[model samples]
Target: FWDILEQPPGSYPEIEKQYFGTHVSLTTDIAGDYLIKLTVSDGYSVVSDTVTVSFYYENVAPSVETISAVYAIQDQTVPLDGSGSYDPNGDVMTYQWFFVSKPKGSNAVIDDPLAEVTSFYVDVPGIYAVSLAVSDGELEGKPYNPFYVKAFSLLGAHTKLLVNEDIEPQLLPYKERFVVDKTLTDDEVAKEYVLGRYTIEAVGKDVTISNISATDHLNLIKPYFRGWSENEIVVVKKGESLTFELVSPPTNGKLTDLSFSFAWSLNGVGDFSMQERFSAGYDFTSR
Candidate 1:
């Protein structure tokens, strides 16, 4: 005789005396534990034994979906969306977001690390790599590739003038201008100018200017003297000045003429008109 002692919730094979046999085979349609008992009798004596079987299904991890890249201005809050992630088992899932890498000196952090959607402020101007993973309470799934976020600054130029002679060099009044060709974020537009400075110093006999800006915001700024490349840039920050030296010191008892011309561009795009054309004549008779 064969009897089912315990079984999962579902219809299972039936055992009856009319269908009894020395050996019986049973199969279940559901995935769970099953217990069965078998007994044999010769007239007065009987022997019984029990067996247990179990079925298991593997759990699938959740799938993550998001954009590959994002672009924005510096100091702006970039949003991250991972609401499209789903679990194959229809299990409740949790979200986890983290930064794989970021620019040097950047302290950007996600607003809500465990939220399906979150955002972070770009502290520095550079590329930031971000990653996302989802948990179905059992298994965790990560995207095949991480995403990138790029932050850039608007174009800006600063012009400085230097007058050098027998006396200590003097830095004349200078001008600064920032150009906006593309749309700007609310924070950027409100501030009108980003926080940072670029400096260009003119040195040596050829009067070549050198880019001395500490940051990488300004890709290139070329200086031209009378529509020619001095092979240099003329830029300086507030409270700072550029120094220019003539090929030869002014001859005594003579008037020397000095002038400079240059054009600048931010991130190597859109040439800006020469901000200043400085020409001056000084008498070197005293020297």
Candidate 2:
């Protein structure tokens, strides 16, 4: 503050301007919560205001509560229970089931998004780890894991065990009718084995027995097969007969160097024991 001023008559007036400081920019994280601040200023003074903002995330995990198991014969359709899952946030949820130890090329059974199955029919016999994973819009939950029942069948052995002229059996033609024998239903001799038709004579210790078939029925049949060599595991093209150790049953008696041979003659009555041929040196345990 200096003095009272006097102006000249033809005066050029000076203008004073007000200026604010810098601009304010805001940002947020995946949750979309934001803190905002405003700057107000003249060239000589500055001030600020505080504010907040909200944002949302779209992806979320799904929730799984329970699963149900349905039983079925091999190759028959079975229903699965997926009623244990829900989207709490009201988002849509997806479902999937899997066989963890499935054989090669069987993954297509459950890979379809449209394979709406409450239970999947199990045709092969084995232990299977079943799993279901679900997802909602914002998140996906952990998969529920469980075990489902399964069984495998011989290539061709069924209810009607077909015997050759020499009382030997062949398993190739009647595979579809064979059901896995959990109990010793058909033959005490082959109580724990899978069903297969063979044209071999019951050579060493096992006796030749009568055969029967189950028609349009859900029945478990105890079955037996002649020991197979590595070469006989599957037909080979220009390959030698295999001589691998027989995968012994849980019983003590085991067959080794088991090999398979085709019937050379349709006329001569083949040895019934030769139908399911086993090596001479291997021990076979009875269940």
Candidate 1's TM-score reads 0.39
**Model 1 poorest 10 in a row by lDDT:** 214-223
Tell me each candidate's TM-score.
Answer: 0.39, 0.30
- RMSD (Cα, Å) for all candidates, in order, is 24.3, 23.6
RMSD (CA, Å), candidate 2 to true, equals 23.6
List per-prediction Cα lDDT, in the order shown. Answer: 0.54, 0.37
The residue ranges of model 2 lying beyond 4 angstroms of the native Cα positions read: 1-60, 69-71, 103-108, 114-119, 152-287
Q: What are the per-residue Cα lDDT tens digits for candidate 1 across 98-180?
A: 99999999999999999999999888888889999999888999999887876654222223233333222122213323222
TM-score of 2: 0.30
lDDT of 2 by residue, 45-87 (tens): 8776755555566555666754433222346444455666667
